[model samples]
Target: MKKWLQFLVLITSITSTSALLASGGIGEGSEGRSSQMPPVMNAKWKAECSGCHMLYHPGLLPERSWKAVMAGLDKHFGESAGLDAATRDEITSFLVLNSADKSANRRSSRINQSIPTNSTPLRVSETRYFISKHDEISASTFKRKSVGSSANCIACHRGAEKGDFSESQVRIPR
Candidate 1:
């Protein structure tokens, strides 16, 4: 009976360890081992949205946020970004599908977790994850001519459009 109990305990330990590793383990902070957002793309979203401003990855926001953003196209950040019904619906679906809540990437998962359940933020800059990460950066830096603003991730993160926000790749413009 003692031998059986010992064997069971050993097996349990090994199984739990294996499961942890398989699920990416208890990674560094909630962001895990990688800060790279998954590569997800939609032609309509890219063209229409990027035509006015930088292309934001869908993984930056949750499904609810995306839904709210989509529903208010006419007043998008105080801009008339209204699109035809078909195009709007397609882009909405694409955004919702790849939103942080649905993305498998660790960084996206962290971003999703940072949001309060009752909150649906339209801007990534408004998320707790973004705030925590940029806590050290001052408002003056964001307002700098070279930096433009916090929303201009591409200004500092060269690979922003590509969904890469790796710490090593960040270069806040002076």
Candidate 2:
């Protein structure tokens, strides 16, 4: 009986530690192991979101931000992106389930931590994390025809769509 009790305590400790780490934190000490956000696929999300714009990985934003985006799809970033009720709900579920706050990736966690709890930014560009990383690049640089805009991560990050934004691979086009 005592041995079983000890085993139970050990299991509980492991579970608690994993949960805390997975919740994401600035001090996660990911040691480069979690820098890449894992690719998550949902057929509906891919088809519906990528038809007009870049396919943003769900891990880029927190759950609240995604919920707000989904709720306001009719006026999505100045364009109508309305969908059938069922499609909307499925995409919303996919996004919320894989949002930054729910991710274990170090970069995703950093992005999640940078956001204030009271704010739900629709654009990832509005996040403090994104601003800090791109602060060195001038507005004109993003406005360049080759770059299009800051939202066009693919302009510099060739692997942006694949969740591989390693600095080593970045190449800003002139």
Candidate 2: worst-modelled 10 consecutive residues by lDDT: 21-30
Which portions of model 2 miss their true places by more than 4 Å?
1-33
Quote the RMSD, in angstroms, for model 2.
11.0
RMSD of each: 7.9, 11.0
Candidate 1 lDDT over 92-114, as tens digits, reads 99999988998878789889999
- Model 2 residue 87 CA deviation (Å) reads 0.7
List the candidates' TM-scores in order.
0.80, 0.81
Question: What do the candidate models score in CA lDDT, each in turn?
Answer: 0.87, 0.88
lDDT (10s digit) by residue, model 2, range 34-78: 777888999999999999888899989999999999999999989
In candidate 2, how many Å is residue 79 off?
A: 0.5
